[model samples]
Target: MGRTKRKRLKKYEQNSINLCYEEHLVSLQKWMSNKGWKNHKKLSLKLFPETGRGISSKITVGANEVLLSIPMNIMITYTTVKLDIPVKNIFTIHESLALFLIKEKEKGINSYWRDYINSLPEKLPPLTWLANEEEIESFPSDIKLNVEYTTTNFKNFLNKIRDFIPNNSTLADSLLKWAYVMVNTRAVYVDPHIICEESSLNLLKDEPSMALCPFLDMFNHNYLSNTEVSIINEGRCLFYELRTLSSCKKYEQIFISYGNHDNVKLLTEYGFFLPDNCYDNIKFTLDEVLKILKFNLDNNKYKFIKEHDLHNNLYIGYDGVSYNLKAVLFIGWCGVINRLDSIIFSSNYPSLFLEKKLPDLIKGLLVIKKNEFTNDLRQIMSGRIVTESAQMVLEFVKFRIDFISEVILEYR
Candidate 1:
């Protein structure tokens, strides 16, 4: 007798038909209504209940005749309970709602959601056309505007990275390390026109708009792949897309329960964490940490001592928490990378580079040294500060020395 073949439905086929039916929709609608989603009209209810690529259900809701599409995914993983939701809902509905619904909810929102929302906007005018000659002339022009990476410099940087990675560092570690030097050493000039709406308007002679998110900068996978992604006309609202995955525990449970035994073996062979679903969580956590750091820096609570008089070694303390020199610089650099043509820096001040790029570079360097250090001698140079140049240099050198010494001692 021939061996019996067991019949089974394909994953997508199962998902297409796995709709929760009217009963579940009604319950969900009620839940939405309770959460103040008034004037809800069910546009269309589609389902893909299976766990795989693009496996999700989309519910379009009409509120006061405004159509809002809600795409949701239920992921079963080992370490987390994951629910992918639309970013607009966080602003439109309630951020706390997702947390309340998901059991054993993780600590933070998925980074993909932010990316998705940010990518949804239409492209705005470039920054070069926005400013007048007088207005633009008033801005700093001393900072090197268009520094390009030479082939030799790029290769040298890559070699340095490769040399460090042999110590068993992860991809994120290497990338972070590179980003620090790229920004600080002025190996690459961050275009100021890309940083802010006012700057974009003034420098580019274009209407003010926000910058798009760069792909390299945005490592999260769930961001909508094919959106224009830009800022609003007023430059206040930014949007993008995001897709989230199941938690590690939930993913493993689903994989095992669904008889995907080979997946476990394959993941193991690739040196991946057994619970593959946790990757998204890790990425999100890192992004959140960076954002928090940016926020703290912007608020001025993070203080930086600026040398006002280089000759007298006189220094003035600039509070990052209340004032935003560094934050402005960072935002500007990020904007430039996003290719937002509508933003520009008017002034040619080299000091902006020092203010905006150095702190984060230092922080990133510390992180790398702590994780992977091989006695590679590194030196950083600062611009001359006539008023407090000596003091600033001394403080910067001391900070770096202390940090390096601490890391070396700790690892030793």
Candidate 2:
């Protein structure tokens, strides 16, 4: 009796029942097989109720285990793209990869990486720039301005690539957006110096770290996920490896960290957020702080703040006000003085000079910000909230209100 193998297979069958049956995934699994992807044997795509499509393992995976190690030839890079124009010279690696997708998609069945492209969302959730004037009113002040800037950049990119687009179609607007978001959300970092041609990458204004890795991007993100990514080069052979830093039992959804992004950033960049994200924080520019607190800084104080880079990274998280924010508040009140380094460096130093006024001020700022979020929600939900983008924004607004409300309640 082969009891050992039977027991293991039974355990596997329990979680394997929910395996994805989508044609795209089926084809992708086949493609990976043909491509000789070397990953954990039990790793497979699963449709989870909560997180949608994610990577799962049939058996327990230990720390430092290599989850997926994709070959370089299969990964899509700027070199992988082919277009009539000097696209590499004109566009960024990100844009080039996106354009590669668009061109490949136009080829239909003849397209390379068709199965991989099919797995992508037809359209990423519409973002702030896509919102109507009414809907834009609901966005946070910081996000609203960023949306405007992003819209302008999008237009600029559109103009530059107008010649390549067929019939000069406005239809390509959605297509282009879909392509760009697909790359932006899923692209992984690769060391270009070792793996790419420096001269070719130099033409693009941005860093050459971006590369699209098939099967690898399937892993969903968790702010807390600890995973190690590396490039393995063996003379003519190259590999992209992703390893787990933490152990996981069978049937658990595996996640990777997308960096220590706050809720605002995660929402803006990925169109998603975790309600209980430890990285969630309320951010403020120096001007926003002054406006909210009704405080003014002399040029010297402003100069001091900027000189120390204390004006940036000013935010309130679950742990309370950030060090930079605290320092900025103290500097604004007390003005820049001798021994300011000691004062800023030492947390207790500011407390000695300040009373409850600073704490009260921070709470006031949170209260006002919460009210703005509440008002934004009112405008957003006024109508049916039909679009996925608006719905995402609404979720973010509600979360911010609750977050701020909790902070205000606890600050006393």
lDDT of 2 by residue, 205-255 (tens): 576678998888888888667789998876667788888888877787788
Among the numbered candidates, top lDDT falls to 2
What would the per-residue lDDT of candidate 1 be over residues 1-412, giving only the tens digit for each residue? 1112222323223424433344534554454344334322222233334322222223322222222212111111101111222221121011112222221212224532232222211221112112233322321221002111222333444454355325424434333333322222111112233433342223222222212222212121121111122212223422222222222211111111111222112121111112222111101122333443443332221222122111121111111111223333344344223321223233333464556564553344345533322221121123332223222223333443443444333222
Per-model TM against the reference: 0.17, 0.88
Winning model by TM-score? 2
Worst 10 residues of 2 by lDDT: 1-10
Q: Against the true structure, candidate 1 has what lDDT?
A: 0.26
